[model samples]
Every structure is written in structure tokens, then in C-alpha cells.
Target: MSHITETLNQRGNRYGEFNRHAEITQNIKKAMQDSPNWATLKPWHREGLEMIAHKIGRILNGDPNYDDSWHDIAGYAQLVEQIVRPPAPPVPPAVPMQNPMRGAL
Candidate 1:
């Protein structure tokens, strides 16, 4: 076999598990997109979720003990969370109401 062919075969072999997990991940993503909240997500948030979902597939597909895969999911989520929605207007504190009975007593 040619060197190029050998390398390609190895790469394909590596992807065998990935291919199965990826199809499952795609279905997961589709379900997420179907939810009403999907429209509210920023593109960055959605992308992060997609990447995290892929990691989840890896974890669930006979590799639940893999630490880095879990970390990768957290890392992706953190990246999106770091720049999540714009700041909300600061809420004003309520003024204490003076009771009329206080002075009348």
C-alpha cells in the first residue's frame, strides 16, 4: 500500500467512533434548536452548545471517565459565557416609605 493510503486508513480508523458519536450529536443539536429558547441564543452561545454537545457524545459513547472531554465541554461553555448577553440596567434601590402613624404617635 502507498504511504498516503496507509495514512488515510489510519485517519479513517480514528474517526470510526467519532462518526457514530457525531450523528448522535447532530440529533441532539436538532432537538435543542427545536426548543423555544433556541431563538433567544446568540450565535456564539449556540456554537458553544454545539461543541459541548459533541463532547457530551464522546463522554456518553463508552468513555464516561475521560476527564479532558468533560473539561473541554466546560471550556467551550466558559468561552461563550464570558461574553454572554449585554448588561442589564442597574436596578434602583427602593426608598424607605415614611409611615404617617410614626409622627402621629
Candidate 2:
């Protein structure tokens, strides 16, 4: 499995309960909807990570206005993972090369 998939799975296993928590889920959705333009404004990959880190720090620091829960953090991390390690492209089948001099040999 890929690193991103592994990380996501591990997080899911660890915090699966929050996935079903109505308040947490709603908070995550609200946070995302409130910041719709952040992704477009900060197009750089690193900028995205920094933004997530900033919000996480706010939560850790007990910022009352920043109501993002662990679920929100995980969602942001998953987004970053998707951006950093996108799915691999499908491999094309190999074609047999004809040897012009094979019969001539």
C-alpha cells in the first residue's frame, strides 16, 4: 500500500469514532465551506500545508474562534496527501518490435 493510503487508514482506525460524530463532522464541513477560497489563493503545495499547520496550532493553542476539531485536521492532512502523492497513471502495454533483419539472418 502507498504511504498516503497507509496513513489515512491508520488515522481512520485510530479516529473512526469521530467520523460518525455528528458535531465533529458538521464542524469539519463548516470549516471547509468557510474557507473555500483558501485553496485557490494559496495554490502552492507548501502553502497548503502551512495553512493546515496554522489552523492546527490555533486549535492546540485554544483559540476560541478556531473551532476546528481533530476531524478537520485529518481532513486537511488527507487533502495534503492527495496533493503531494497523487494516484499513479495507468501503465500502457508494451508493443512487440518487428526485427527487419530477423528473417534475413
* Candidate 2 lDDT (Cα, 0 to 1): 0.58
Candidate 2 segments exceeding 4 Å error:
1-43, 63-67, 89-105
TM-score each candidate.
0.63, 0.33
| Candidate 1 Cα errors over 4 Å, as ranges | 1-16, 85-105
Q: What would the per-residue lDDT of candidate 2 be over residues 37-105, giving only the tens digit for each residue?
A: 645544545455555654554453344344455667667778877877868999999999999889794
Per-residue lDDT tens digits for candidate 1, residues 1-105, read 999988866644543465777787888999999999999988998999999988777666646776887899889988987797577899999999988888584
Please estimate how well model 1 matches the true structure, expressed as its whole-model Cα lDDT: 0.79
The Cα error of candidate 1 at residue 48, in Å, is 0.8
TM for candidate 1 is 0.63
